[model samples]
Each structure stands twice: as structure tokens, then as C-alpha cells.
Target: MIEEGIVAFSGWMTNFELLSSGWRAGLIVFGLVFGTATVAFMVSRVIAAMERKFIETRNIWDDAILHAIRLPLVFFIWLQGVYWAAEVAYYYSEADVFTANDALLEIGFIWVVSWAVLGLIKQIEQVLVSPVKMKKPMDYTTVNAISKLSRMVVIITVILIALQTLGYSISGVLAFGGVGGIAIGFAAKDLLANFFGGFIIHLDRPFKVGDWIRSPDRNIEGTVEQIGWRMCTIRTFDKRPLYVPNATFTTIAVENPSRMSHRRISETIGVRYEDIDRVSGIVSDIRSMLQNHDEIEARQTLIVNFLAFNHSTLDIMVYTFTKTSEWVKYHEVKQDVLLKISDIIIGHGAELAFPTQTLHVADSVKLKHLEHDFGRDQGRGDTANEAGERSLRDNHEEAVSQQKSVEKHYAKPR
Candidate 1:
């Protein structure tokens, strides 16, 4: 009986010890999680303050950086906290899974840092290349190439480092990758060519996003939307998106109409031939109007003169350039100037001409010449009819003479 009591007492002590350890571990986990939460709150507050300060700066890139880092920084802080907790558990707990948990937490931390780095690189690009007035805007093709290259470098480096840290042999992976690369190269020939073409476009910089481009090779005209590896996206004026292969830009001659300094307004105004006396006055007045107009470009070529005499009207050509290159403003200015020109023509009692053909007969010599020609034609017609009638009568007399000769010859000899 005394031995059974001793065994039962030992069992109770063992259970008590297990319960105590469980409570301690629970306390530690709770304490670490709570501490992490507190630190995260403090860090987020600091970042919010920094963001506000950055936004007040004149340079917009700084603000953009702050925004980019905000979420990543917070995420990193929490990831670090999880790593520390796992590290704590690994040290205290004698369990096999704890080691794995710690390793995973470390890897997670590395990945978060890598992700943050990528975000920073992308955000920095905006600061480095986006301010058109402060810095030269990067070419669309080149910018995309740089961004993609940067991302690849970061990811590959991180993966290699992670693999090395995890005690994996990289040589076999590299060998396998090399063989796979050859196969992929053959299979994706067009894709690779398009990627190479993207590189050329980046270097050449024929067009960029939002710039209007038209290809003389075919009927492709639109504003650039995005330049990518395999294809470029263009948004047309008709509110549709066009996808073009990047390789096409390398082969075709592209015209960047968006880069033009000014828009042209060349027009031909025709006036009635009766307004000949007012043609010179109208040309000079129109030239003055173009010069004095604020929208008309003064430095460019402005030609307003009586250009040609059409069959029905006098053509006065007005060729000039508008100061603005915008499509809407150019048309508005052109419409206003044309209306003013119309008003000027009307005030001078001149009318716009249309398609017409007029026969003008001169009273002096040309009229007499036309009458004499008509009489000659009529006399020729009368002579032709008289000759035709005389020929018919001769044919009748010849037939009758032949008939009488035949009758005399065929008659019985008397």
C-alpha cells in the first residue's frame, strides 16, 4: 500500500510540472506577440509623420518614395517580430518543428526585405526619370527594360543567396537551367525577337507613352499606351486599344506627330471672278489678319496671296501655322480665323465661288469669226447634199441608158 501511494504521488508531480511549463510557454508567446504589436504601432506612427513631412517638399519623388516604403516598412517590422519569436522558441523549446519554424521565419524575413527593395527601386525610378521639366523622361522602351532587368537581378540574387544559405548545391541547378534555356530559346524565337526589338526601341526612342505615333508602313495610328516586352499597347482616338508586336516598331518607319512644335492651317479660298478688282485688297487684308492674330505663329511661314485664276473663280491661298500644337486649340483657332476671313470677304462685296463653266463670247472680233465659221460649215453641208443628189441622178440615167441598149440589142433583128 505504501509503494502504490509513492507511485501515485510521483504521477501527480509530473502532471503539475507539465502544466507549469505549458503556462510559461503560453506567457512567452503572448508577451512576444504583444511586444511586436506595440513596436509596430510606434513605427507606423513615425512613418506617418515622415510621410507628411515628405509631402510638403517641392520634389514629388520624395513623397512617392515615402508612399512606396510605408506599407513595406510596416510589413518588414512584423516579419522581423515573427522571426524573433521563432528564434525565441527555438532556443527554449526542445522540439524538431521549432527549428523548421525558425528557418522559415528567417526566409520570410529575407523575402520581405527583397520585396521592399524592389518597391524602392520602382519608386526611385519615378524620382529619377519622371519629372519632365526637371529631368529627361526615360524612353518608354528603355524604361521598361531597365525596370525588368532590375527586378530580375534582385530576384535572382535573392534566390541564389537563399539557396546557398539553405545548404543547396547551385551547380546542378545552373547546369539544368542552361539546358532548359536552349530549349526555351528555340521554342520562343519570336518572343525573344520581340524582346530584342524592345531593346532597340528603347535605344532609338522613336515614341513614348502618350505620344502620338503613325506608321507609314500601314494604317496604324494611335497614342502609345504602354511598351512591354512582347507587345506595345496603343490607345486609338476612337477609344479602342490596339496591341502591336514590339518587333514591328523595329521594321517600320514611325512618325511621331506629337513632337511637332506647331500645327498647320493651310487653306484655299476662292472668290467670284467678278471680284477681281477686290482680289489684291482681300489678299493684303487676310495677310494682316493672320499676322495680328494671337494664335497664328508669327515666326513661321505665312503665305497669303492671290495664287491662281481658276476657270470659275480667283483662288486666294492662305497658308500659315498656329502657335499651339494641341489638336483642339488648333482647330478652334483655325475655325475662328476662317470665319473672320469670310466676314472680310462679305464686307468687301465678294462672294465665294463654286464649280461652274461659263461661255464668254467677245463682241469685237471673236464673234465675227464664230459667225464666219458657222456660215462656212453650212455652205459645206449644202455642197455635200447637192453632190449626193447629182450622183443619184447620174446613176439613174446610166441605168436607163444601159436598159435601152439591152432592149435594142435583145430585140429581134428587123
Candidate 2:
């Protein structure tokens, strides 16, 4: 029907002898351009109505399909219209540039179709991952990985097809790529490593976005914000952004605290040595308290024992886990447990230990005697003090002898 209309229009244009070929071509070009705009507008309006209608339906595929094709369809229409107008111009002007019209049309069609397919893939990925759109939303990481792989495949296929359309052999391209791949791999070894690291992460599923992960091998303690092909972004405790290469994860061991079942609260409390008799009772009371506490995980390793006797204090170990794993809530639970332990100790009439020291000395007479001897040594003064090593040694020996004699005088028969 459209061909017949065009033929009738051409016949009608030929009947106008007054109009030159250039003028007729110009009119046709104007008509084509105006028609393309009108067609694009109509298609957009039709797609908008279809989108509104499909959005209400339960199936999401229709919406995705309509959305993906809307812009690309308009573009395809414009391309065809312009192609036809250029053909007419070429026929009249015999231009050399328009000779590649067929290749350009094929390439443009491939590009448009690839664009639509990519758009559809992206839309489907979004719909699957959106909690509001899907009843059971898919994992964002998995969906993203699949979407990326699919898009890459689509892109590679499109490129190959475009090359074939431009008179390039697919087999030759593949052979050259296979041979050049080795050199490319060597040149971009790190880049390839990071890429493969990301791929492994996607497959292994060690940690995902929003997981609190820390690496003992590296100073990487943060919540995962974004995981990309080359690097991962982490938000640290201090709210700083850290960009780490994906390859780094391949070598390091990551601890995902977010996946821990419980947070440990291991502490050693000590009491004064005087509370030796009360140590057992305190330990028992602490264990009972932990067992009855709402926040403590009694089913796990609950250990409250008198660990050891220190110099000034008796050590009591409190090793247990909290029922909660949230960081802030875990601290609160730990604080409550510690305060309860303190109360239990106080109730048991035991005091927490502190560092202390005691000094022992001889009787007052011995002290005075020592003081007198020290004064006598001072009285020997600068002459003995300034004496050479031999003289000082002789004086020290003399003092020792005199002190022994005095001690003998004060000694009793017993």
C-alpha cells in the first residue's frame, strides 16, 4: 500500500512540467523529513500509551520490550527516511559519498537492534532486582553479574555481525584475535587479574554489597559499597571512601563480620587478694547471671571461672557470646553484662583489685644503727671520698669490719 502511494505520488509529481527535477527532489526531501518527524511522534505516543497499559499488568516483559524499542524504533524510522531522501539526492547529483549507503544502513540497523536488546536486558535486570517490582527480589550482585555478561555477549555478537556486513570475514577476525590475545594478556596482566578477580568474587560469593568485611592481611576494614570489574569501593568506619583493586581480594582472607552468628564478649575481671574465699562465689554468681541474662547466648560457650591468682588480685575470666551481632547493640549488651558482673562482685562483698605495694623494714634500733653507720661514712668525708679505688676499697672493708664488731657486741646468746 505504501509503495503504491509512493508510485502515485511520483506520477503526480511528473505531471507538473513547470517544476524542475531539482525542485521536485527538494520537495520530496522536505516531504521525507516531515514524514519522518510525524512518524516518530506517532510511534512515541503509541509507545507511551502501551507503556501505561502494560505497567498495570502483572507481566513485566511487555513493559520492558516496549520501553527498549521506543527510542531505537524512532531512530530506525529516521534512518530509513533519511536514507531514502539521500538516494533521491544521489540519483540526481551522482554523488560519490552516497555509494556506501547500503553498508551504512546495514550497520545502523545492527546498532539499533543491539541498542534495543541491551536496553531490554538492563530493564529486566532492574525489574528483577527491585523489591517493589518483584514479589521476591533477586540478589542484586547475581542479577548484575548476569546482566553484564549477557550485555557483553550481545555486544561481541553485534560487533562480529557488523564486521561481516562490512565485508570482513568472521573466521579471520577470530584467528587474529586468538593470536593477539597472548600479547594483550601480557601487556594488561594486572588489568586481566583484576577482571578475573571480580569474576571469581561474583562466582564464589565471599561477601556482597553492604557487608562489613575486614582483612587481617591488609588494613581493609569497611562496609562494601560497590563492587566493579576492576575495583571495589568500601566505606570505612570514619566515613572515608577506599578504592581497592579486585585483585587484592584474591590474595587476602576477608572476615565478614556481618555474617557472624554472634559477637564475643571475653573479659577478665580481678578482685583484691583479700577476696580469696569469695572467688568461687563470685564466679558462680557471674555464670548464673550470664545464664539468666536476656542478651547473652547461653547455648554457646559460656565460661565464668576463677582463672588464676595474681600478685594482688584473683583473676576471673568471663568468656561468652551475645545474642545480637549488631555492632552498637553488641556493645550495649556487653556493657550491661559488665555492670551486672560488677554488681555481683559488690554484692558478694568483694572489691575489684588495683595495683598496690607493701614495704617491710627492720626494727627501729636496726634502722638507727644503719643511719649512724651511714653518717659515719659521710663523716669520713672528702678525703676518703676523693681517695683512689684502692683506698676507697680499704675504707669499705674497714667499715664492714667495724659493723660486724658492733653487731657482735649487740648479739644475744640465743
Candidate 3:
């Protein structure tokens, strides 16, 4: 009995020793996890602080980079901690299978890596799309399309890689997807057409994002807001959104007003007929003003001429082009020129014409001959009326017969 009791006590002591060692290992792993997590937290804070400082003084690329990487960095920190903790626990506990814990860490690693790669892609896109970053900047539409396509490719590749790592048969999956894609292609012909149209638009460089385009063939005119894969979103002047199919751009004529070299100002100036003698001077002064004005284009046509005589007044024409292509600036320049022309005309003692008519009368003797002769008509009595009625009846019957003859000759048979 004494020997049996010693044997039992020895087994209990061994189990207690194993428990103590595992507790020590767990404490060490806890310290490691906490220390690493604290470091990661401090690093993230530092990055955030730097981003804020950059925003206050420098360009935004630094801020964008930090923003994109922060999540992935934090995720990787936790994954590393978990991995080290599992390794410590396995060594202390004498367990042979770390399958479950390793699997979780591995999956987390994949997610972190994928996220980091995607973040880098996003940073690249943001930098490239920034208007101030590049000297020869690409338009927003093209950059946006390329970004989306790249992201899709990256995501698909990452997903497939992860699946393969997890013992998935990628060949069967790809074959199925290929067959399904063919079926879907047939089902969505119009959608594919629009997709290709969008691709062509990006390649051919038509109207870009933010451009004001007008369709002469259709009722579409607006500022481009988003160029999507299937369609483009246009915000009209009245502040309504219009979704136009990409295929429509390929079929119709689009006028991009944003690309115009200049804005035109054409007007007709009518003057009082009495001021017709001053018209030539007014035109000469206007032409001089246009030629000397800073906003008027030097190469474009400038016309200030006496156009023609109207029913009530003489007309002058003013036609010119502004140097600025922007609408607001063009209007400002136009108003200044118009105001100057008005001042010049008023200073010359000439008035802008309104519609008017004039009538003249002859002497009273000639006016009397033109008066109605009612007394002569009163002398021609009922005899004249009866003769007129008989002649009118004969003419009416003859006209009716001629009309029926013409209708019978030309009308279609039933």
C-alpha cells in the first residue's frame, strides 16, 4: 500500500509540473502578443500623425498611402501575434496537431496580404488620378476604368490563389466559369455591347469626364459625372441625372462644348432711321474697340457693319468671338464690349431703334377724288340688282359643273 501510494503521488506530481510549464508558456506568449500589439498600435498612430501633418503642409499622396495601408498593417500585426502564441502553446502542451490554429492564422495571413496589395493598387490609382500630381494628367474616365479593371483582376487572382492554397481544384472551377460565361454572354448581348462601347470610348478619347456634351440627334445635353462600365451618368443643366447607354455615344454625334477654342457673341443692332447717317461712324468705332480689346480673339472674324434697311429703321450687325472658352468669363467679356458699344452709340447722338411706321397725305382736292361715291351707287336701283342676281346664278352653276369635272378626273376609285 505504501508503494502504491508513492506511485500515485509521483504521477500527480508529473501532471502538476506539466501544468506549471504550460502556465509559464502562456504568460510568455501573452507578453509577446501584448508587446507586439502595442508596437503596431504605436506605429499606426505615428502614421496617422504623419498623414495629418502632410495634409496640413504637403501633398495628399502621403495621407492616401497611410490610409490605404493602416488596416492591412494592423491585421498583419494581429496575425503575427496569433502565430507566435500558437507556436508557444504547442511547444509547452506537447500537442502534435496545430492544424486548426495554423489554418486560422494562414487564412488571416492571406486576407492581410490581399488587403495590402489592394491598398497599394488603390494608392497608385489615387495618385495617378489627382489633377495636381502629374504634369501630363490623364482624364478621370480613363483612369477610373483602368483602376476598376485592375482591381477586378487582382481580386480574382487573390481569390484563386487562396483557394488553391486551401486544396481547391482551380481547373474545374475555371472550366465551369468559362462555360457559364459563354451562356451569360449570349443572354446579355446589349450589356456586352455597352461594355465594349465604353472600352472604345476610353481608347478613342471622345468627351472625357466633366466634359459638357450635347447630342444633336437626341435630347441629351449635360456635364459628364461618371463614366461607368455599362453607362455614363450625366448631370444636366437643370440638376437632374441622366444615365446614357455607352453604345449611344458610338451611334450619335456628340458636341463637346468644353473643348471649344472660343465663345461667339453675335448681335443685331437696329438704329433710328434718322441715325442712319451716323451708322458708319458707329461701326468704325465698334470695330476699333474689338480690335483693341484684350478679350477678343486676334485671329477670329470680327464684323461691325451696317446690315440693311428695315421696315421702320436701319440695322447694324455686330459679330465677334471672345478669347476665353469658359462660359462665365466669356459672358463677362461680352457684357463689357456690349456696354461699351452702347455708350459709344449714345455719345454719337444716335438712338437704338424701335419699330415705327410713317404715312403721308396728299392735298384735300386729290383726297376728295379718292373718297367713296355712295350717291352714284344709290341711283342704280332694283333693275341693276335683278340683272346682277341672274348673272351670278348662271356663273355659280357653271363653276359647280367645272369643280365636279376636276374632282372626277383626279379622285381615286374605290
lDDT of 1 by residue, 194-275 (tens): 9988777777778877899999897899989888878889998897999999998878899998999999998889898889
Q: Which stretches of candidate 3 lie over 4 Å from their true place?
A: 1-40, 49-67, 82-104, 131-138, 358-414
Colliding pairs, model 2: none
Candidate lDDT scores, in order, read 0.78, 0.87, 0.79
lDDT order of candidates, top first: 2, 3, 1
Which digits, one per residue and each the tens of the lDDT, describe model 3 over residues 179-287? 9999999999899999998888888878888999999899999999988889999999999999999998889998999999999999888778889778889999999
For all candidates, the clash counts are 0, 0, 0
Stretches of candidate 1 off by over 4 Å are: 1-20, 57-70, 84-96, 128-145, 357-414
- Candidate closer to the true structure by lDDT (higher is better), 1 or 2: 2
Best TM-score among the predictions, by candidate number: 2
User: TM-score per candidate, in order?
Assistant: 0.70, 0.82, 0.71
The number of clashing residue pairs in model 2 is: 0
